[model samples]
Target chain A: MGRQYEIPIGAQHISLLEPLHFKFTTENEKIVATEANVYYVHRGIEQACCSKFKFRQVSFVVGRVCGLCSISHTTAYSQVAEKLLKIEIPLRAKYLRMLVIELDRIHSHLLCLSHVAENSGFEALFMKTMQYREFSMELLEAVCGNRIQYDFSIVGGVARDLKPQVAQSILERLKKFIPQLDELMDIYKNNWTLSLKNKGAGAITKEDAMRLNVVGPFARAAGLAIDVRNETEDLLPWKQVGFEMITETSGDVYARNMVRLRELYVSIRIIENIINGLPESALITETKAFPDGEATVRLEAPRGELFYYAKGNKTQILERLKIKAPTFSNVAAMAEAFTGNEYGSAPAIIASYDPCLSCTAR
Target chain B: MNKVMTSIENLKKDIGDFYKPELHHFMVMNAVEVGDQIEVQWFFSDYAHPCDTTCFYTLVRPETEIPSIKDIVASAWVAEAELVDLMNIKVENTQKGFVLEPDFESGPLRKKK
Candidate 1:
């Protein structure tokens, strides 16, 4: 038997973007086992949303769960809250929500791609990706008036209506972005340097992904074909906004990068469709009703499926609130995929997973 | 979207019969307190149809040892460990602090008495 050594990385590490710790047991250069401790950032947000916040205020509170997927969290909460009240939002509000979500996906996927590039020792490509990502952040600022916590979604509907100028600007910027996205797709798909560091380094099989019940790009990359957007039509009308499922068969770091890269094309398409056919109506639904029953929502966050469950008893405060971030579901598989891989490529693999720990730990 | 109320004893067979990885994707395990009991629900989605959902739930006392569905669904381990750590629920082969530190005084979501 080869000598085994246990190596621990981060509750804080240079390569780890989140406050998560992983302990890997290695024999020579290959990992044999892995353990993860990822709750260092847990802030009891769920409890706060239930006890400290009113039904109307909980939408903004849940928005803080993860900066990257702030829109997803708030939108899901609003949808569940809408369900509890038994009222539907305006078609205009639904279209605006879809617009911001696709924009958020663009920046989020690029950020993940940039981190993956940086972790793989390709600093130049990382820089290039980040430069391309800035446009989405600026667009978000114009639309929602904030960069991190858009607060775009409120209880009954969206907080702001899309101005014609802003809509036109969005289309213009996205038109310019298409060529940039195509450029990124070519580099991610054909780049020899990235392939060496990522191609087969960290891999999980389709059966393993299904067994683990993985979601989002992690599941899609493994050929699972699971996306909340592809499933539910009762909420935001994802199909009408041109939402499409993107998947890759490899289930490795390389395949994950490709999935994120290719999905940006779909995101761009959704944004264009939303802008081109946005309906005109009231922004907020103005419900005087209190949430009186149980409701659950499943949303496609940048990383994976974000689930929210809430219960109310005709009171201002919710009875219970649960936020299940995508990373939490993948935590088991995160550990499982590390086994039998060279420890040197761990950083890139971790980045490819695109974890949002604050969302999970909340 | 349909929800069924079941118990810990039937958790395995109920979920085992319902879950086929190729056909269904297990979603999540959710918990909420109602009166003196905790209501826990298991969620699953059909892959082919995508819109068809099956949820199996149970209401139990706070101390009940809920059976883990890890054997039936591999990813149930995280959900099981999370319920133990945050909701203070008891489940087989799962430990607390999977999401919270072990020394924390109480489960974060446990209702204050």
Candidate 2:
């Protein structure tokens, strides 16, 4: 402990989208330990869900948990509610849900990659990634009528159906976007400056990740083959839509970026498959049942596994609603990643985790 | 989903026996208040087959201090601290004020008046 001191990084920082406070204890410019405070954005959504909102209305309310992964929140909440209601959605509705989820995954990954680039001091790459990310946003707007916080998912099924022309347009846009993604992947992989900055800055080994209960791209990047989409087949037919889990063994910032980029391709492929094999059915089912039991739902959000627990007592209002966001689970791993790294690279390491404080604090 | 009801004293032993890091990934630890008791659920899953979930729940008095599983599953500290802040459930060897600011009171997830 020779001349040890503490440096604080944002409750509001340029690299962070939401408020997250980190106090890094450093000695000779290397981090020895870290303390994180992520409660700045807590809005009591869990209590509000049980006390304020009805079962049918909770899906839309939970969608406000995080703007980027709002689809994941809505999907997780709807699945839990649907389980309690015992509603089996139609094939067409399932396909539409999968389509929008894949779209959301693509945009969310691109946003994260761009943020990582910006934090790593590659401003040009950040701008380029943002430019390519616009295509996914435009496609989402065309389908869901809004860029962010799209309330396309309802309890029994989806709120809107995708038109034939909209599907065709999505296919065309994805076709045009693949080449751009390939070029971006090339740059991400081969850029010497980026590789130097991110290659091993926040590396966490497989054992540490497992012990820390890491999820999603971070876990997958560390060689963990855990994906909720691969596990939960009853919710959606991800296999039928050509969903494949992408993994990297490095468990570093570069590895995380590679995993996200590759998953973007996987999401695009799933969207294309859904468009090609889309079935025709009712957008939403007519169900007059009320929830009277408890159900737990877990889904793979862009960052990681988003979990929701809902309990009802044969009434319109729920008894309790519990949400454990991926970032909430990854908090320990995030703190661990800060250790054994230089203080200067903290922003890039934090950005590589792609934390959603609003989701975590909710 | 498999549900196992255990007592507060046997929670650590039961969870220690059930949680195999290679086979099960710790999902989350959740606590809900029921009348005079607080129902705590520890969720774990087989990542290879995620549909298979093992849930271990224990009901305790609101003031009872639950043993922390941070020694077994290191990441559980976050969840343990969260329960302390949100549900007002006391847990041993865990920090408070994770989701609530230091100046604010705890138990935001509890029933309101």
Badly placed stretches (over 4 Å) of model 2 are none
CA lDDT of A268 in candidate 2? 89
TM-score of chain B of each: 0.95, 0.93
Over A191-268, each residue of candidate 1 has an lDDT whose tens digit, in order, gives 998899899877988999988888889888888889889978988799987888899998999999989988999999
Report the number of clashing residue pairs per model. 0, 0
What is candidate 2's lDDT per residue for A19-134, written digit by digit as tens?
Answer: 99899999989999999887798888888888888888899999999999998899888889999888898889888888899999999999999999999999999999999999
Clashing residue pairs found in predicted model 1: none
TM-score of each: 0.98, 0.98
Q: What's the DockQ for every one of the candidates?
A: 0.79, 0.81
List native contact recovery per candidate, as a fraction of 1: 0.84, 0.86
Candidate 2 local accuracy as lDDT?
0.90
